[model samples]
Target: MSSANLDQLHRSTLGVYESLLDQFNPGLQRLVALGKTYIQAFQALSSTSEEYFHALGRMGEQALHTLSSRSLGDVIIQIAESQRRLTNELDGMFRWFHSEVLREMENNVKLDKDFIAGSRRRYEMEVHNHASALDRQQRRGHQDVVEYTHFLRDSQKDALKEEERRYRFLAEKHCNLSLTIAQLMNKMGGALHQRAEEWGDCVNETRASRPRTPSRMEQMGMREEERAQQWTKREEPSLGRVPSRGPSPVLMRSRSGSLGDGLGGGRLMRAIVSCAPSPNPTLLDFSMGDAITVLVPEPRNGWLYGKGQNSPRQGWFPASYVEPLDQAPRPPLPRGTNPFATVKLKPTVTNDRSGPRAPGRII
Candidate 1:
């Protein structure tokens, strides 16, 4: 009875495990699908960003081109205008200083004249009463003149100091403005250089990674005929004529069918692989120069579902990897050969290891 209960419990546990797995599988597939979608979206965004940068670079180049076409006279005119403005500002400052100095000197001279006149009047009025008053007035007048001369000298010195301070301030301001302009120009130059370098690198990388497109002749059909002829010549030295001797059975069979039929039918199409793919359940791993069949002509998220012609296995591959055969010229088949032939399979050997070997017989 205990053994029976254990068996029942074991069966129940297995049922639960199976139920959990059934629920998880659909969710897992959804997650994988979402991941693939995200990858494709990210790739598109990256390509768009690259194109935007390219456009910005082109605009910068165009601006430089326009600047190159401008005349040197225009630059000279701009410099002249700036110099004229500076000169006008300096002239205004000097004029203000000159007017201030003139006004101050006039006031000082007027005060001196009034004081001298009052002393002369007093000396004249007291001449009869006191003869020494005349001498004293003369001495006072001399002292006042000396003091006025000293005051004038001091005023001139102060004016000179003020002028020096104003000139120093202007010089310092001009120097600072010049330094700021130089820094700004340097930054602009550096930024332009960096952007140009990035654009150049991007262009080089794009050229290296992108496959070269076939020329007009190759695309139109002339090149395909030539390639087909070359392939035929390489494969068959004799141009469809019966050999002098009896031809072998293999030779009797047309070899033209081995090469793919022309890309006429919608059901059949050929492509040359340009890029390799990583291992994925939906995608096939293919290398460069490999030929593949397009099961679906249109792409889904930049990926195409296809089968390798040589491999004959179906899977998804990047659309960019293969060029469609419809664009190229199709080759005509030689006369008297089936366009489609059955692929031959090698006979399989049966191993009888399951049965006991008789003595003296090789196993």
Candidate 2:
């Protein structure tokens, strides 16, 4: 073929491809928009469901309150109101579901029809253009025609593949919608069950003249006691101490003592350092499990001023780092001994080579 004819053929083919793309692009965009709309609709449905459930809960509370008033007429009215509200909610949900389904179906049908028509029109235009170009270039051999035919086939195949992909996407979206509907139904079923139970309880309460069984608070307290007993049984071996049924003697005694006098001489409170304090100029550095005396019960700006039991160091530390021990039980002291008294050191007798040394060096 002549160079001019070849160039003309190339431009015509390019135009046909550009035209196909332009036609397909809008269809693809519409499909994406449809998918997004479905997602948004589902989200709105979920939010509506939540609001409905919340309203139902409020109605249940009102019913309970009416029942508590011990007026059978009021309870009956409340139950009737609840049933009416439930019926309305169910009707609204059904209407919404039907409308959304119909709308989605209509949109899908329209998109499919538009896509099919556009594809058919583009295919015809492409074939006509290729035929005209081949006729103008009659001098070209059979091989050239074969190659051009192959290109057209490949383009047609690509368009078919894109259509299939869109159909698959739509199918998946339909499946998702079905799943969401099923989930909403399940939630509604559960809510219905709960409402029925509440109604049954209210009816029973009205019919029975017997004293009320244990309230929820009493039941919870009993459960807590059982759990505590189980926990103490499991922990006693590890703790190496028997679990007391009531408050320990130590705790009772500690509660009886004044806060300041509980520690020693009404000046300090003994505690064990449970954690190491961060390095600070004003804070004392102590290891974990070290004993200390709290000089101040309350912290000043998140720091506690305390003195270490083993060391003479007195400084501030984080209040969280210590466990108070002033309330713990201790052995009784001797009759004449003061608990906080300083010990007096006795003089040491040393034997020299010549004679016994004077008792002057007191340790």
Candidate 3:
């Protein structure tokens, strides 16, 4: 199944073949030597005379006759037949050795080729699967980037609309202030006219009662002198009560000025104060990619905190038991404030009487 397993099988098979060769080698060597001796003997016999051959046979017969064992002739014939069959089998074994070894080697070669082919096929299939997966991931990543960019653009447009609304509110407040001042001025003018008419009536009543002791000119002079002094006090517009216009765009913009330092001072969208151990506290940790989360003291299965904050509460924690989770890459920050920072918390309500069931106050 595996390349390593296949290799071990091949090694084992080869070891067996080597061991068999070792065992058969000595027998093969002995057979080769015996055959060589027999060939030499035959060559000498071919050159020998007919008388010598007859004498050799008589000598063999005399030797056999001298043996006292019964059936010596039969025994000699049996021994000769046995030698012939042994020699023939030995020769057959030698001849087939070449064919057998060749066939075995061919089978081993075929096995090796098959193992290599299977391994190559498996490797190729794995590579193809990996490539397809990578392509899909790339496509998904591209889509996410496009969606994020669109979201940022929409946020920017919303911010611009909010700024426009603020300016419009300031203009309306200014107009209302102007109308209130006009109304106050009209009321003051009517009061002044009524006072003047009352003075004229008093002068006519005095003239009708008696010949005017002080002339009209004298009365007019006194009135003019008094009026001049009073006018000085009322010279400046009394529009302080008539509300000055609300802060103009210029003044509002000044109040919300840019940061003096290089680092901007806009509200943080998210401020995660990670109390993780520093590599070298004396030096700055420049690893911006690192992120951290606050680890609430609890079990892994979210059982300690209950379902919500309704349970008896504990304060927020820092990054004590937490590890950083890798975040996807993000773009650079744009210049703007987060409106959420402007939200105010509701005032806390407290009961006068102290009891076990007293409500929690949101201080």
What TM-score would every model get versus the actual structure? Answer: 0.22, 0.32, 0.19
Report residue 157 deviation for candidate 2 (angstroms): 3.6
User: Which segments of candidate 2 are over 4 A away from where they belong?
Assistant: 1-79, 91-101, 131-140, 145-150, 165-176, 179-183, 204-363
In candidate 3, stretches whose alpha carbon ends up further than 4 angstroms from where it belongs are 1-62, 65-70, 93-98, 114-122, 125-131, 134-363
TM-score quality measure for candidate 1: 0.22
Q: Compared with the true structure, what per-residue lDDT tens digits does model 1 show for residues 161-209?
A: 5335434644564465466556655755566567556656655664576
**Cα lDDT for residue 211, candidate 3:** 54
In order, the Cα lDDT scores of the candidates are: 0.47, 0.57, 0.39
The residue-level lDDT of candidate 2 at 357 comes to 54
Native-structure RMSD, model 2: 22.6
Count of steric clashes across candidates, in order: 0, 0, 0
Which window of ten consecutive residues has the lowest lDDT sum in model 2?
Answer: 238-247
Q: Number of the top candidate by TM-score?
A: 2
Q: Write out the backbone clash pairs for model 2.
A: none
Candidate that would win on lDDT:
2
